[model samples]
Target chain A: MTLSVALGPDTQEGTRTGTAEATDSLTAPDIPWNLVIWNDPVNLMSYVSYVFQSYFGYSESKANKLMMEVHRKGRSIVAHGSKEQVERHAVAMHGFGLWATVEKASGGPGGNSGKSGGPGQGKGKRG
Target chain B: MLQPEERAGQDPLAALIGLDMDVAEPTDRAVKRLLPNVVKDDGAASLEFRQLTERSLRETKIGALRAAALDLDKDEIVLTPEGAKHWSMALNDVRLVLAERLDIRDEEDAEHVHLMQDWSQAEDVESYLALVYNFATWLQESLVQAMLQSLETRR
Candidate 1:
């Protein structure tokens, strides 16, 4: 994918340092499914952000924002699209060795209210 | 468990080609981590999804690994962007498998493994594996940092 418009060097460098934390979650109104990247001990934070930037063509700052979310919050909904779109992204993420899962943006019956739930949802850190 | 070998029915070609039509959910936790359910808390749907997609996913990973291996034969390896991407993916996968074997389930476990730096201190299998894992992690991290720089330049 083509890279989007460039930001200042300072903006890119700020993301690389990664001290900033994103308070608001990423959201897409029309997209019905969410692709969530979960935190793991094995994956490097920089590698994870790089995947977000390269694979999805997210801006560096945006990618680092999501990566930090996963690092600090245990998980982050990094992408939103149709079921097929998100599922396809999930497979790509698995290919990259990142733990990812797709879910309906509108939580299903008996599912946790996804919007209100904290980042801890469905974070089953198994062996 | 996702046992392709047993299912390939003694056909070396089938096994070599990774042809398993009736693969089950992986019982091995490490394998499970590698090929996790796409949908959470829904095994039936996840299994169906896996049957449809897991084989190709495995092949994609294997292809990346093969590409990286081929590059290793050259005296001084130089990576095209595609080659670099494949190497990054290959190294990440290696780290994943090693982490599973090392039982690095959380940050604390990872730090414990990271402490195994000295080659002379490799007394047992686990410690040796930890060192390898740390090395892979370091290698991947450096590769990614370089990639990020490239991204910045292109931007």
Candidate 2:
């Protein structure tokens, strides 16, 4: 049977997590890590974009841009953070059933641009 | 499709405790798709990560599945934000398992499967699975579109 979209009340308070600020002081070299989302035939395009917006609190446009990149390029680094942070995001993505992997940002295919700001750090844009 | 492993004459407490003495990567392709390696090209590291996190991950997915199942009984299901999240996850997992069973390895395979829409055409197990997979995909797309609309309204 074809399922219809019947949305219930949207009453849950949107909990936007605070974006982690850039930290300059570090004793140990905290090389950046990336949370890469791979394209799959199973996951819906709209669902993937929604995940980016809701979970990372990215803006709609940014989420769509990244989602399109994943669809076209086969993969996209959706978020950047410290190794631990990106690992946590990877776990969350897996829970959503998206194919996600974590790797060092510097060595990955999309090499780090030295611009540390990325959606994975939860850049404070809601909706 | 997701069920707790049942071994005869084994301790039932193992499931409750959420610990297994020996855990290896799942042999089934469908199971592997659900719980994939987090790190690319690093078997040892991925295995270590799986050992640390796979149990909790299984529990989380199961929890979502159970919640979605309960809502299925309602005459007109009205979901809260949390309920929608669970439903989305459950439906997505279901689709992943179906896709694997259908052997939909690429876009071409998915397109071929999409051709099996009519119930009358389902003469084999493979065709039946394809229809089910397509249904789940359509349902997920609708839910996601609703979610995106809500997000827009919130902005």
In model 2, the number of clashes is: 0
Give lDDT: candidate 2, residue A127. 20
lDDT of 1 at B34: 80
Candidate 2 docking class: acceptable
TM-score of 1: 0.79
DockQ of each: 0.39, 0.34
A1-127 per-residue lDDT for model 2 (tens digits): 1122333222223532223422332112455677899998878777888899999998776677777778778998888777668877888898999999887665568754443554335222222
lDDT string, candidate 1, B1-155, tens digits: 22234442556654555444476788878888888988888886677677668887888888999999999999999999899899999998888788888888888888788888999999999999988887887777777778889988998
In model 1, where do residues sit more than 4 Å from their true spots?
A1-30, A108-127, B1-21
lDDT of 1 by residue, A1-127 (tens): 1011232122243535333333223333455567888888778777787899889998877787777777777788887776678878998999998999887666643122334543344334211
Candidate 2 Cα misplacement greater than 4 A, ranges? A1-31, A113-127, B1-21
The models' CA-based lDDT, in order, is: 0.74, 0.76
